[model samples]
Target: MTSVQDFATYIAGLPRVLASAAALFRDVEGRVLLVEPNYRDGWALPGGTVESDTGETPRQGARRETAEEIGLDRTLGRLLAVDWIPGTGRPPLVAYLYDGGVLDPGDLAAIRLQETELLSWRLVPREEITDHLPGALGRRVLAALDILTQDTGTAELENGHRVG
Candidate 1:
């Protein structure tokens, strides 16, 4: 039989993956909102890593990150996509994408970028999303947009390719 200490040790030693949640905001023109992080090469949705250490769930994390990154505290819509990305150097990543709903001109005017982490934000047309986001992330955003357009259920993805 395993001792209590042994069980704790085993749990602590288990491999862990990183998780993040993002909000997908769109303008009335149907363009997607993207932010350019000061520390990254490409633009990203308004969200960040889930504070799992602090016991924050994915939806909560998405809301918090959206408010922090863009100063938009509106209610988020349904889950759009979830992608499991295989690890390259760091641990694997599970990304949750939530709908941020459409923003009117007033809401768009009210956006305040968290300048410390973001350089700028823009609304990219569907065909131009890949130009801003690139790679797997671009694919994920496109898939999420497709889901919204088709009124389909949530998307499950591996490396940003829709699986089921």
Candidate 2:
């Protein structure tokens, strides 16, 4: 497993912000996958910073992150959107969003979360997501879901402002 110190070093070596992939998985019932952070109180999508030495494509990174975080091996879907999360002390993060589909229903029942970073995992509706997730992350999750589900007429940000 990669440590935060190692990740920070990797980020420091990069010329620009590090690119990452987040897998958005939805069940037939329209419940999306969310993970609660053990270190933090809010929920977030199952993902991680893209490793420089992994030799995996962004889609592969998304698959690996989903399995590691939520124990799922699913078919990856469209390259939804890329987001630039402002950096604090470290470099900013360039996150690639991908649409992922659940391969097996049984995997959902047998989820074994990696406890170091995650506290628990769930498949909940968009309406309930706001309750479990923090403000900005929750909005991003819902926006990504809307883009994937085609629920919103426009795939762009709801407020008509560009996402940096």
Candidate 3:
């Protein structure tokens, strides 16, 4: 499993263009899975940039992230949304947010944390996501979740929101 820092270093060393997948996992109980960063102390949806080794599709990247980060076999749903993180000393990130459903809840409970990146994991209720997440990523994830649940074509976020 690749650590987020290692992944960032790898991305930093590459060319300016980058592609990533943000996989949103939801359970029947209506709780979403979120990972807490070790260094930043904030919650984020579990997923990562697409790697060359895994091929070019965002769906493939989402599947890989699920196995690597959360230890689950998930069925990839529609491409719910896309957002771009403007360049800030590093390459601009084009993140593809996908709606993903897990095959088993027990597998989620059995997740093995990659300590270098994630400090811990939690199943957070929709109403309480804002309290747990730190910043913009929270808003984006929640918006994506709303769009996914409603089967809507667009997600609405506040300032700095990006959807494609």
Q: Give the number of the best model, judged by TM-score.
A: 1
Q: What lDDT tens digits, residue by residue, belong to model 3 across residues 1-164?
A: 99999999998887776778878887778788898878776778888879955465878888888778766657778787676666668777777778877425676767887777788888898889879864666677777877877888855333227533
Give the per-residue lDDT of model 1 (tens digit) for 1-164.
99999999999999999999999999999999999999968889999999999999999999999999999997899999999999999999999999999999999999999999999999999999988888889999999999999999999999999895
User: What's the number of clashes in each of the models?
Assistant: 0, 0, 0
Backbone clashes in candidate 3 total 0
Candidate 3's error at 31, in angstroms? 1.8
User: Would you estimate the TM-scores of all the predictions?
Assistant: 0.97, 0.74, 0.74
- Model 1 clash tally, residue pairs: 0
Global CA lDDT of candidate 1, please? 0.95
Q: Which stretches of candidate 1 lie over 4 Å from their true place?
A: none
The residue ranges of model 2 lying beyond 4 angstroms of the native Cα positions read 1-15, 102-105, 151-164
RMSD for each of the candidates: 1.0, 7.3, 8.2
In terms of lDDT, the poorest run of 10 residues in model 3 is 155-164
lDDT for every model? 0.95, 0.73, 0.75
Say which candidate scores most in lDDT. Answer: 1
